[model samples]
Target: MMPQTTEMADKLDVLDRGSDGEQRSQPDVTAQSSKVSPLDVLKTDLPAGLVVFLVALPLCLGIALASGAPLFSGLIAGIVGGLVIPLISRAPLSVSGPAAGLAAIVFTGISALGSFSVFALAVVIAGVMQLVLGVLRAGGIAHYFPSSVIKGMLTAIGVLLILKQLPHAIGLDVEEFGAMSFQVGKENTFSLIARALEVIQPGAAIISVGCVALLVFWDKVPALKKLTWLPGPLVAVLGGTLANELFQRNYQTVALQSEHLVRLPSTDGAGGLLGALHLPDWSAITRADVWTLAVTLAVVASLETLLNLEAVDRIDPWRRKSPPNREMLAQGMGNLTSGLLGGLPITSVVVRSSAGVNAGGRTKAVALFHGLFLMLAVLFMAPLLTRIPLACLAAILLTTGYKLAKPKLFSDMYRLGWSQFTPFMVTVLAIVLTDLLKGVAIGLAVGLAFVLRESMSRVYEVSREGQLVTIRLNKEAFFFSRGKLVSLFEELPRDTHVILDAEAAPFVDHDVADAIRDFQSSAGLRNIQVEVRGLKLAPVAPG
Candidate 1:
C-alpha cells in the first residue's frame, strides 16, 4: 500500500475544519476522531441535554405506545439512553432512547410472545448481538451506503412525520400509532384537517397552531434566531403548555385533561421512579419466541442507530465524527441495561442528537444532564408534565419531520448524481409505501444491483502507438474480468510490443493473473513482445 502523502493529510485537515464550511476530503463519517476540553464539553452538554429532553419526552411515550409496551417502559428507555449510555459511549454528543424504528418489532414481539416479560428476554439477547457486532467491527458497513440514499431516507422520514403527526397536532387521535395509511377513525391528513375544522377542539388546535407559528417565526425572524441559547422547540413546547394552562384557568375554553394530557406514569412518590425499574424474567429466556424477537429487535435497533449516527455526524456543528463500532458498543450496553430494568429498546435519536449539538453540547455530559432533568421531572414535576398538552408534543415532532423531509433535501439529493439519486429516491418511496427495514432492503437491493452492474462492466482501455500497445485496466481486476481479458488478447494484433499496467489496479485476482500468464505464453508464438508493469511498485504481489 502507498503511504499517505503530506498533501493528503492537509486535505483531510481542511475537511475536518469546524464551522469553516469546507468540503471534507473523506466522505466516511466514522473514520475520523478529534479532541475537546472537559469544561467545554460539559458546558455544551448541559443545554444539549435540555433540548434533547424536550424532544425525547414525547417520542419515548409515543414509541412505547406504538410498540404496545407500557408507557413507563418508554421513559425507562429514555432514562437509560440519557443516563446510562453517556457513561459508556465512545461518542459524546449522541443521545439514545426508545427508537421509532423498533415500533413494528415491539408490536410483533408482544403480540406473538404473549407477554412483556417474554419481550424483555428478546431485548436482552439483542443487546448481546449488538455487542458482538461491535466486537466484529461490522459498523464499517455504514460507509457503503450512498450519501444520496441516506439523505433520501432521512428526508422521507421527515415527510412521513408531517403526514403522521399532523393529525395529532390538529387534535385528532389515531387509534394506532402514526397511522401509516390512515384507514380507521379519522384516518389520512385530509380527513384529519376536515375533522379539525368540523369538531374544532379550539383550545388544542389554537395552541398547536400557535406553537408551530412561533417555531417558524423564531427561526425566520433575524433577532429571534440570534438568541442561540433559547432552542425553538423548547420554546414551542413550553408556549403550548402555558397556553393550555391559561385557557383552563379562566374557563375561557374547556380544560385539556387526560384526553389531551402528556400522561406520566402515576407513582406513589419518589420511590415510584425506582419501583418502575423492571428486571429480566429468567424463565422467559428459554422460549424460542424470545430468541426470535431478540434477533428482530437487535437488527432493527442497530439499523436505526447506524442511520442516526450518520445523520448526527453530518449535522455536527464541530464536524467531529464518531467511531461506529464504538457507538454500537455504547448502544448495546444501553439496551442491555434498559431491558434488564424493564425499559423499551433504545437507539440514537436524530432530534435529540441535533438538540444537543444546537444547544452547544460538546460531549456526552449533556446527555447525562438531560437524564437527570427527566428523573427530576418524574419525581418532582410529574403532575406539571401532565398539564402539558399532547398537541404541543405533536408540534415538536411536526417540526422534526418537516426538517427531515424539507424540499431542499430532495433537491440536494437530485443534484448528487444518479448513483446517489436513484437509491435515495427508491428508499424514500419504499419507506413511504412500507416500513423502515423493508424500505431499506429495497434500496439496498437496488444499490447492490448497481454495484454488480458496474463490477461486470469493468473495462481495460488499450492504446497502440506505432509497435507499442499500452493497456490500462480499471480499478477492479479480478476473476470476474478474466473472460474480458481473454477476449481482448484474442482481438489484439500479433507480433506487437505490449505492456500490461496493473499499477492503477488495487487488486488482480489469482485467476486474472493466471489468465495474464497464459496470454504471455500464447503470445510468444505470435512474436508479440509482452511486459507487465506497476507490480513492482507495490510491497507485495497484487491480489
Candidate 2:
C-alpha cells in the first residue's frame, strides 16, 4: 500500500478535479434555474423571510404615514407585493413593496383626486398602464440610464435615510420615516430635524444610541458574526422594547409614549381582515384628473420598478440578469391587486430587497414567506409588534443608509474621473434638492451631453506631415461634425497638397458631404491640389 500522505494527496486531487468539473459544467445553472426545494426553503428562506418581515413592517407603516394615507393601506400594499409580485417576477432575489419614492406623488394625488378611494381608482388605472407598457416592451428603456446616475440614486437614498431617521432615532417622532424629498409640508428635511431637536426625549435618545452601538459592534466583531442565526435588527428591536419598558416603569419623565411605537391595526379574525380591505371608488373613473394621475403613477411606478430591478440584479450573488418586461408585468399585477384591496401603489423596493439579500435569501419563497409573516403578525402579533420602538427601526435603517452612502463610494466615483463623478454628484444633489425622477432626468441630460461631446470630438482625425495634410473621416460623420470639417478646410496651408479621405468612413451626412464638396470646389480657387476618395454622396434631391 502507498504511504498515508500520498494516499490522502491522491484523494484530494481527485476531489479537486471533480469540483472543477462541476463548476465548469454548471456555469449557467444559477441564472437558468433558481428554484429551491421545500427543504431548502425551510432552512434558508424562512430565516430570510423573518428578517425581511422585520424590516418591511415599520417601513410599510412609515411610508403610509408619509403619504398621508391610512396606515393599513401600506400593510395591504406590502402584503400584495410580497404575495402576488414574486409569483410572476423572474428575479429570484428582488422584493416588492410600497415605495418611499411614490409617497409624495400619492400624497398629492389623493388631494387632487378628492379622496383615498378615488386615488385607489387611479392606482388601478396605473396598473393597467403598466401591463400595457410590459406588452409594448418599454422596460428596455432602463438599459439606457448611465451607471453613474444609478449609483448616485442609491447613494442619495442612503443619505436621505440617515437624515430622515435622525429624528426618530433621537425620539422626536413627529414626521414619519422614509420621506426623501427635500420638502414635505410646512417643514422641510432640515426644518423637521430642527423641530425634533426642540422636543427630544432622553430615554428614546439613549435607546437609539445603544441600538446603533449594538448594530455597529455586531457588524464588526467576528465573535458576534458566529451568531448569525439571530438577526441584529431583531435583537436591536427587542433591546429597545425592553429598554422602553424599564424607562416607563422607572424614569417616567422620559418614558416613550404609545405614539413612539409601531401601531398596527388590531384585528380579531378572518372577518376583521376582510373588513380592513378598502375598495376603489368606481365613480371617479370618468374624471380627467383621475386619468392624469393614473398615467403619472403608471409612468413613475414602472420606472422605479425597473430601476430597482436593475439595481438588485447587480448585487445578486448569482449574477442572474432579470427580464425587465416580466418584472413590469409582475409589478403591474401586484399594483392592480393592491389597488383593488385599498392598498398603496407597489414597486420593487431597494431597502427590502437589500435586506432579503443580506439575509441569504436565494429564492422567491423568501418573499412569499415574508408576506405570510406580515399577514400573521397583523392577525395575531399586532400587540407585540407595537412594543418595538421606532428608535430601533431607525437604527436598522441608519446602518442600511451608511452602507449605501459610505464615504468609499464617493472616493471610488472620484477615482473614475469627472466624466463619471459629475453626473453622479449632480444626480445626488438633484434628488436631494428636488425628487427622484427629476434628479435622474438631470443626470441623464448631463450624461447625454458628455456622450455628444465625445462623439463630436471623434468625428475625424487630422494629420499634417511636411505640409501634406490628410483628413481621415471617422466611421460616420454627422451634421454636428460639419463645423469642424469646415474649419479644417479653411485652416489648411495654402499650396499644400490636401487629401480628403472618406474611403474608411461608412456613412456621411448630407450636410457634411455638401460641405466637403464645397471645399473641393473652392480648392481650385486657392491654387491648392485636392485629392478625394471613397465618398459616395447621396443623390441630390430634385427641386
Candidate 3:
C-alpha cells in the first residue's frame, strides 16, 4: 500500500479490529499491552488520569443525582470504578464509574426497591450475576456484532455527546447534570438545544468557546504538541475555573453560578467521607423484587460494559486485544465493591475512556490514577474542583465528539457500499434517537437481514456450457430461497438442457425439491431437457 493508503487502512483497522484509534467516547461512553513501564505510568498515564479524573468527577455526581440517589454515591462508584476495574480488566484505557446510561434504570430500580440501601443490595447481587456470566463465557457474544454496527454505535455516541453537551457548553437548559438520554423528564435532546439558545450565559459561553478553541489547535501547533503530558482538558478546566473566578471579581453579571460548576458533597472533617456511605441492606435479599432488580441491573450493566469495552478496544492505539471475559470479571468486582461502599452501580464509561485516549493515555494507570484522584477529591479537593465550570468540560467533550463523528468517517462508510453503509447509518440514527442498546439491536437486525439475503444468493451458482445449463446448490438452500431459484429456472433458454445439481448442499428444503421436480416434469413442453444430480427426487415421466 502507498503511505497514505496504508495509514488510512491502519485507521480503519483500529476502528474495526478493536485497535488503533485516533480519538471521544461513546453513552455519554481498547486493547493494548497487558504490561506498562513504571516511567510510562508516571509521565503518561498519570497526567491522562488527572485529565480523566477532571472529566469523571462531575459526571459521577451528576449521574448519581440523575438516578435520584445520594450525590455522594456517584463519587463512590467513580472512585471504585477507577481503582478496581483497571486492575482486573485487560482494556487498558477504559475508565469506569457511575454512567449516564444507567441513571433511568437506577431511578426506576430505586423506586421499585423502596430504598437506596435495598437498591444497593440488588446491585451487589447483580455483580454476582455478572461474575456468573463471565464464567459462562458470555462475553464471546461481543464477536457477533458486525463491524459496521459497532462503528455506528461509536459514531452515534459521538453525536450524542455533542447534542447532550451542547446545552451544557452554553451553560443553559434546565436538565440536571449527566441526564443525557434522548429524553430527560419533559425535554428531549433537540428541544434542549432550543432551550439552551433561549437562556445563554455569556461567561459560560466564553469558557466553552475558549476551551474548544484551545483543544482544536492544541495538537496542531508544534509548541503545544511537544507537551503531550500537558493535556488540553486539564488546562481548559483549570483556566475556565480561574476565568469564572475573575468573572465574579470583575464582571459579576456573566459569571457562571454554582449550578454551572462541578457539584460534590463536602467530604471534609475527620469522618465526613465515612459518614456519607450507605451499606447495602443484606436483609432485603429474600424479596423477589430485590432479585428481579438484581437480574435487571446485571444484564444492563454487563451489556453496556461489554459494548463500551469493545468500542474502546477497537480504538486502542497499540492495537491490543483485551479479554472480554476479564472485562466482565472486572466489572463484576467493581459493581460489587461499589454496592458495598455505598455507591451507585458501575460500568466502564465510554466518555472518560475516549477522553483519556484523546489525551494520549497509554497504560492501565490512567484508570487507577483517576480512581485515586476521586478518592483524594473526596478526602480533600471537592471545593476547589467544584470551581471548574461545566462549560469548559463540555468543550472538551464537544471536541472529542467532533473527532469521533468527523465527516470523513461518514463518507468513508458510504464508500463501503450499501451492505456496510446501510447498517452503519441505521445504527447511528437509532442510537442517537433512542438509547445505546436499542440502537445496536436495530442496527444488528438490519445488518443480519443483509447477511441473510447475501447468504440466500450464495446458495446456488449458475453456469452454461453449449446446450447445458448447470445450477449447482451450495450450503443449505432454504425454502425462502426457492422463489429466486425457480425464477432462474424459468428464465433458462427454452431449448437448452438444464442440469439441477445439489452436491454441495447439506440439506434442501422440501419446497425447493418440489420446485425442481415441477420444473423437470414441464421442461419437455419448451423443448428443454432436464437432468438431475445429487437431488433425490424421482425422475419425471415424459410429458
- Model 1: per-residue Cα lDDT at residue 248: 80
Per-residue error for 475 in candidate 1, Å, reads 2.4
Task: Please give, for residues 23-131, the per-residue lDDT of candidate 3 as tens digits.
Answer: 4222000123344457656767788899988888878887888899998899889999988888888787788899888888899999988899999999899998998
**Candidate 1: residue pairs that collide:** 44-360, 44-361, 45-361, 45-366, 278-341, 508-543
- Which scores better on TM-score, 1 or 3? 3
> What lDDT tens digits, residue by residue, belong to model 1 across residues 262-336?
767778676876676666777877788788778888877888888878867776654567889988888888888
> Which segments of model 3 are wrong by more than 4 Å?
1-35, 463-469, 475-498, 505-543
Q: Taking the tens digit of each residue's C-alpha lDDT, what string does model 2 give over 4-42?
A: 355444443342211001221222232224444566667
Alpha-carbon RMSD of each model: 7.1, 6.0, 5.5
User: What do the candidate models score in CA lDDT, each in turn?
Assistant: 0.73, 0.82, 0.84
TM-scores of the candidates are 0.79, 0.87, 0.87
